[model samples]
Target: MTKKSTIKVEEVNNQIVDWLKSYAGHSKVNGFVIGISGGIDSAVTSTLCAQTGLQVLCVEMPIHQATSHVTRGREHIEQLKKRFPNVSSVEANLTSVFDTFITTVPNNVDAGKVNLALANTRARLRMTTLYYFASVHGLLVAGTGNKVEDFGVGFYTKYGDGGVDLSPIADLLKSEVFLLGHFLAVPQSILKAAPTDGLFGDDRTDEDQLGASYDELEWAMSQAEIHKSSLDFTGREKVVFEIYTRLNAVNQHKMLPIPVCRIKK
Candidate 1:
């Protein structure tokens, strides 16, 4: 895997800010809306939105998250509001909402699958909240998923975090995102903190679910080229390919395009 980066983080930040400005202007939307999860991706994406000098609605939609996670999310949004006049934020604690969904849904699944489904439901709930505010305010829902999560590993939930009008950092790798975060002066705590989806309710992290670190995932992603090449892969390359294939299988559904059936005349 290549350790050196050709992309300039500062330039990327400026370009994304500019893109957001132009997109919102052309689309005639008043501003951008983002769900702040206290992870670096949300922190950087929201900061980039703030940098655009346009109205940015940062919502903290916590669903039975850890106290620390909720606090971090709230504090980050507050910081954005204090620093950027165009930034505004609100909290949508969906504990009751989620509980209602769980209790109301059909109780026909096993315990582990039920937990996974509920976690994903949290993401969909946040997506619903974001679009609700966007519709009310004439804004676009801004997504926080980075390249590794969005494209490489497809770690995001479909129509959940994946449902957004724009993904400002979707092209940025996890490592590159941290670079942009550091450049944008995002809080050091957020930068260094362990990344989590906050979807699993209490304290489960992304890595815990994926069974690999971002660095390893990134490295594993780089092996796709080698996996497809006609040239032979050595022992290490094969091992990495195995990990990549296993992790990537989890995203097969995410990678599938919307199913369409042909209507025969």
Candidate 2:
């Protein structure tokens, strides 16, 4: 696999920043609200929104299981505030909310399903908070999904992390996000930190669930894209076939809206 040195760092950063500014203006959102999980994706999102001169609110929501993550999240937010003095910070403890809801559910469900449901609930709660603040503060919920997560695997929770007014990095690969971070001069600590969802027990990293590295996934996606455009299916056919097959099979839901019918006029 190719290493990080192959990509043009400066060009990606400039393009991303320019696109972010243009989208914010076009959307006419008064500002942006971003959930900062002490992870690179959210950190990058918050930084770019703040740099765009948008009124940014960095929210830290921690359940009992996520206390340490919250502390790290706050530190990153502080770093962002130092760079962009206009940013604001807020804390909302979600422990009680999660506890109450989980306790109400029966324990007979599969452990994996129950865990996923709980994690998804936490994500939706964060979105609810973002929308509530946005409504009162007249801001848009800024999304933090990178292309590798959002497109290649459909890794986001619908109506949860997926509930965004506008996504600035929707087209960026995971590798590109890091390059942009370097350009923004984001703290080395945050840049090097392992990526996590912070929904399960502590130290639960995203890569643990994906079963593959971002570099491999991205290369697969590129090959799949080329195959779609040309339909040759010649060299590298096996790899390209596997990539598209997995993406289509796993991300079927992303291709469809919540199933509903429009009343015929």
Candidate 3:
């Protein structure tokens, strides 16, 4: 069962918009820059940034991306532009760049590790692109990570999708992001599409990589918070809890601050 936050959408929406406006105002930046991935998280995040009525740059960094993802991303960008005058978009096709990088790197390892490394490379390249735009425009790179992925399972790249100037929706879960997305009137194509990182250039979903759905992971997260043990669960629930715990442990490096070696002197 998917557990959704009981947060009041309208109230939370207003709070986030106000918060974004305040943060940008204090930081003396123009606005936000977000990578549109045709997924609910980005759609909702960009919309929230738009609600601030500040400059919001929706960037498309596609590197051998799936057709559906590109289409949905373009659709959402168009819809957002129509609704907000402060919204603008740019597409940075990185296919050739990715191909060049692949050739430059040594791939003596097996195909599996090579593919995984390249996928992460795609994310890092996009991160660099976003920061490039942000630097040029004097805007903040807004992150699209939600609570489940950012906190519970740590399902984001280290400095890739994980890199950002600010996280506007990091407190919300995947389900809560959908709720906010629905309230924000994000494009239906994005709302209905399967969640993907678009890093692998294939149709494989976040679930395919994570071994559990967002809903199941959300449930497991809640159970863990209550100090529940694997013995408390049975069947698929038990399996999911184990999966969530394993990932949460291994990916703590991603979630926590970078460890600095301290001097005992």
Candidate 4:
């Protein structure tokens, strides 16, 4: 069974719409440019931006992306266009661009490190592509990261998927994002699909990479807030807490602002 959120969906939805509209108004940007990855977070974010009646440009930057990801992304964009006249779409196939970068860069490094770096490179390329569209259209690059990724585990790349002009749903957890997606009528294809970054160009899921389910991670996040320890739990709960603390500690760099050297004044 799906867990329920404590938030009032109707109220939260309206608040996000107002927040996006107000931010765009104050920033004096044309609208928002988002990278739609056929995932729940992006689907919900783009939908919220559309509800503001501002121009929303949904761009697909596929760098060896899985077929399912592309299909669902297209489906969501098409449905969103039908529902909101102000929403539009574009496609930027970065497969060749990714190839060129791979060949140009030195590959004498370790294989595992290279693979991970290349996966992050895919996201960085997409980030560059999104900014390109945003600049051309005088729009802001809207990010799709949720609270779990932005705070809990730091699952996103440093300046890749993590890079954005503004975030509409960074405060919401993954489960909360799913709830908001349902309330916004996000396509079932996305809402039903397992969450994946689609950067590795393989079938592995976010759970496979993170070593835990979002539900488990959410519970861990809550428990961590109370300064709970493994002594407070047992079995899988303890195992999950360990995973959460380990990741949260190691990824603090991504979660915090970059440090600068202090100088005598």
Judging by TM-score against the true structure, name the best candidate. 3
**Local distance difference test values of all predictions, in order:** 0.83, 0.78, 0.93, 0.93
* Candidate 4 accuracy as TM-score: 0.97
Worst 10 residues of 4 by lDDT: 1-10
**lDDT (10s digit) by residue, model 2, range 108-199:** 87998888888889889888988988888888898999987787778788888899988888888888888888877777777887778887
Write the residue-wise lDDT of candidate 1 on 1-265 in tens digits: 4434568877787899899999999999998999988889999999999988888999988777788877777778888888999999888888899989978899787988988888889989989999999999999999998878887778988999999999899988888998888887887778878999878767777878777778767877776755664134556555555666765777877877878998999
Off by over 4 Å in 2: 3-15, 65-68, 226-244, 262-265
Model 1, CA-based lDDT: 0.83
| lDDT by residue (tens digit), candidate 4, 1-265 | 1234698888999999999999999999989999999999999999999999999999999988889999999999999999999999999999999999999999899999999999999999999999999999999999999998999999999899999999999999899999899999999999999999998899999999999999999888888998657788788988888898999999999999999999999
lDDT of 2 at 93: 77
Model 2 clash pairs?
A: none
TM-score quality measure for candidate 2? 0.86
lDDT (10s digit) by residue, model 3, range 81-179: 999999999999999999999899899999999999999999999999999999999999999999999999999988999999899899998888889
Candidate 1's TM-score reads 0.93
What clash pairs does model 1 have? none
Clashes of each: 0, 0, 0, 0
